[model samples]
Target: MKEGYVIRDQSLPHFLTVTIVDWVDVFSRKSYRDCVIECFEYCIKNKGMTVYSYVIMSNHIHMIVQSNEGKLSDLIRDFKKFTSKTILEKIQSEPESRREWMLERFKLATESHSRNKNFQFWQLGNHAEEIYSEKFMWSKIDYIHFNPVRAGIVSNPQDYIYSSASNYIDLKGIIDVEIVQIPVVNVLKSSSVVKYNSYEK
Candidate 1:
């Protein structure tokens, strides 16, 4: 709705990236990151948002998600709105060293946007790309899971506690994700084969 970014099919899984205002590393704190986790979990439980994979970085979150209720855009709008208010409140009440600086950035961001009032925590528009094929889906998933590794935060993707890679590897993570099995036509075996069989659970 913001221009080129369009959720053509609300029911299909989409790779979404939501960034913080001024690229602020708000999620550098576990408490703030947990706030995002809580909101995603709530959406999964109550809003029929099926999350295939997700990773929370220092300033942004990348998620592969689809809405069962055909309201992906609406879900994202509410998610941004809620997280903005919740995180701003946390920054105000909590003992944050960068409290004033962060609030000022939020205030400036709000002033730049007419729709926002007082403060703006997240940047406008989600960089969304719909998954049209198994290759594309896996590519995006790998990108999301390996973000922390690419950023030199961890040696292995699974070592990042804020990503769904742990869950894919049969390890416990911040939250459980719905693993989508990719079906491939194997020319070697001359049959269709499924990858990620361990994720059947």
Candidate 2:
């Protein structure tokens, strides 16, 4: 296991989340935050990456995405590459006198990775799991939304501005997108469950 995260996967539809080393909250920057948006937009537009749910935390990001073309890895790689380049370039090129310290911090943090020519905006090998059932999917989704709330960053899931919870709860500032909305508790209802044993993974 690398970085205490099990990096095993051989298929699509993997629920994925990644964090900066030491959980440094790099996403707190507005330009860095927009890098993520641009990456997702790129994947959605060109890679057939269907996003089910997402939550952008201060240091990490949780997303449930599936690629129909079996190119999930390619999509993720490009997204990370694009975001890192854009965010790092933005921080390095900021001419504001007060922002010089921030550039220093980024440069120091990324010094170890030879793969990166400069600032490494994200760490390698994201934590990911296959959503095998309704229960798994619901649990992951709930875990994501409840993160900020449990951390006391927000009182309610909907109060966190950078998450899908706001979309699920108050239908707040998120852009419209198609999603396969699954119920949280219906998986526990055995009577309501439809067993399709005829299907194969």
For candidate 2, the 10 contiguous residues with the lowest summed lDDT are 192-201
Q: Where in model 1 is the C-alpha error above 4 Å?
A: 182-184, 187-201
Q: lDDT (0-100) at residue 199 of candidate 1?
A: 28
Worst 10 residues of 1 by lDDT: 190-199
Clashing residue pairs, backbone N/CA/C < 3 A, model 2: none
Model 1 lDDT, residue 148, Cα = 88
Q: Each model's TM-score, in the order given?
A: 0.90, 0.77
Candidate 2 C-alpha lDDT tens digits along 1-201: 245544245355678987765577677776677778778777888778877678888889988887767777777777778887777677668654434665566567667767777666677787778778766776676777677877888877767777776666555535433344545465566321222111111
Say what the RMSD of model 2 is: 6.7
Superposed model 2: Cα runs more than 4 Å off: 1-11, 95-112, 171-173, 184-201
Clashes of each: 0, 0
State the C-alpha lDDT per candidate.
Answer: 0.84, 0.68
